[model samples]
Target: MRLQDLSAALSDLESNHRLRRRATLASPQGVDIVVDGQSYLSFASNDYLGLADHPALALALQQGVERWGAGSGASHLLTGHSEAHQRAEEALARFVGREAALLFGSGYAANLAVITSLVGRGDAVFADKLNHASLNDGCLLSRADFQRFRHNDMAHLEQLLAASAARTKLIAVDAVYSMDGDEAPLPALLALAERYDAWLYVDDAHGFGVLGGGRGAAAEHGLASERLIYMATLGKAAGLAGAFVAGEGLLTDWLVNRARTYIFSTAQPPALAAAVETSLRLIEEGDERRARLAQLAARCRERLDGTRFAGGASRTPIQPFIIGEDAHAIRLADSLRRQGYWVPAIRPPTVPENGARLRISLSASHEPAQLDALLDLMLQASG
Candidate 1:
């Protein structure tokens, strides 16, 4: 870990095309944006409902700053938690059909908080192989006996559950896989949780504000249980910053008192909380937006049906066209960027080795013609 060693590591990453870079965004997040001084029809955002730059949300943010100021001076346990945060938390809890909820700065921190506080060395945690990195890190850091099931494999999970002799057992999964865009078997997982007397933790970062009429993945599955602990991000389809973990009342009580991330971190700005309040109302009334998003995704899938970059089993907006090599995926993304489309190439360790892809992130703001034009250019490139 010396400076020279770090430099060597960086060089190794670049040589293998594993280096990462950030584009300079000159405009707000939406389909049409200026990244690195170029205007582009972009498909590189998670703003599924296209509300990131909504006038009302922007105005609400401004008003929030006027009412509360720039930052919360302390953590929630001190004086940082505001009336805005309280109201937002209450709304979030009700929206997700939970007895309570606790806000966090980001989904990563939320996952860590949930995992670490609930389990220790005497406990056990079973996770999906494809769960988000944060979840994996959380489990590793929890000092729990960590067991991983094959992706979406219930029998493996059951075997692990049946074999564990720990004081407590928890099952962790993503409601919708972030990269693949497929859903977990929540009903079956819940049945196993009930059968094994374990807790179920669901990270629904990519499903909220788009599924279940914006009530979230839990509602979409028509499932509920006191055993379920749910976390959804506000920054995705909700078009705001922060996350909230919701579940039975006592669960939140434990997090508030025991979760290190929440107890130690400064609260998100009051402006963000106010904007989230506005975003929640918008998400609840966003049926038209969701419909448009679904239509756009379906059309793109249809257009790519016979192409080399055919769609996978994803039903959500995250359509990944796996190119199998880092260099190839980067080249495809670069070619698209030159043509005024801004698709992103995703490579490891974000995905498995040799599974690099052009991640097509769709939004309700996208028009059919825009998508069609991109696909035509794509087909030309691949052809």
Candidate 2:
């Protein structure tokens, strides 16, 4: 009976062209990669600054292992928290201009810890419709009155905020929308949070090491307030693993005491923390990489202009070519793959119905000729 049910569900997904498949990577993450023994010019990674395989980061990881070993052997409140972890947290807080910071194993864990710790049965969580899955999951896990406003629509957010009577209200948003590559209106959201007496949570997973000169989206908009709780993942542009939450001293202390994910999960390896510290330094000094990424993204947009493929108004490294139907997007992706590209088809429930797209993620390591070749291939595939 269980096998029958599972088969039925899988059949439904396959019929809809939404059955997800994982690719096997045999090479380091970069513009060029070997997937399942085949080399491809890839645009499917979130390594925006192309630091994932940096020699400095690898060296730091090596030194960290030599100094601290592999595992933490416990949770943060237990015996897991190491000097390297503390130092990384301090560096993250300072980098984001926050009073304090707490590290988590991943961005999902950090979001769960923050939303669940701060809001509960009597409180509320107001989020954007296009927020990352983790944010929505955190809201559901909190058992809070979860309300979703239209994507980047301030009026809808304000309307929801005005209607909510919960004593504690939290506004959660992505600093940069992961799929669309557009940014949230931080200033307006901050203003609304202040007016409504809500806590504003900014998840800077895609923005931290790539935006605001490496400070992030909130910093880009000059938004620094006690009511703001900031989260950033290091695995992307940082070229390391883990995430951190930054906020006021009191708030971080509260999370340290109350966030179950942080209190229960085994602490991340101390060596990773050491590597993240080095990654932070590299990100701060990675202006040239950022510029290269911007140039690549601009070139992509310029070429795609006046084409049916152009989808969103994103100035960032993420460029989506909307194909509307799932099958069409999948076919386009397969066509590109056949021609030695590795762009993936993003389908629902990753996106809304009829909103399947090719998520063209740009990295600084991508060359001009490669970008031009990709443009030609995309045009040919679409044609």
TM-score list, all predictions: 0.98, 0.98
Q: Where does model 2 exceed 4 Å of error?
A: 311-313
Candidate 2 clash pair list = none
Name the lDDT value of residue 144 in candidate 2. 96
Error of 1 at 291 (Å): 0.4
| Every model: Cα RMSD to truth | 1.2, 1.1
Residue ranges of candidate 1 with Cα displaced over 4 Å = 307-313
Q: Worst lDDT window (10 residues) for model 1?
A: 306-315
Report the C-alpha lDDT of model 2 over 281-334, residue by residue, as the tens digit.
Answer: 899999999999888878888888888866573789898878889999999999
Clashes of 2: 0
True lDDT of residue 305, candidate 1: 85
lDDT of each: 0.91, 0.92
Best by lDDT: 2
- Residue 65's lDDT in candidate 2: 96
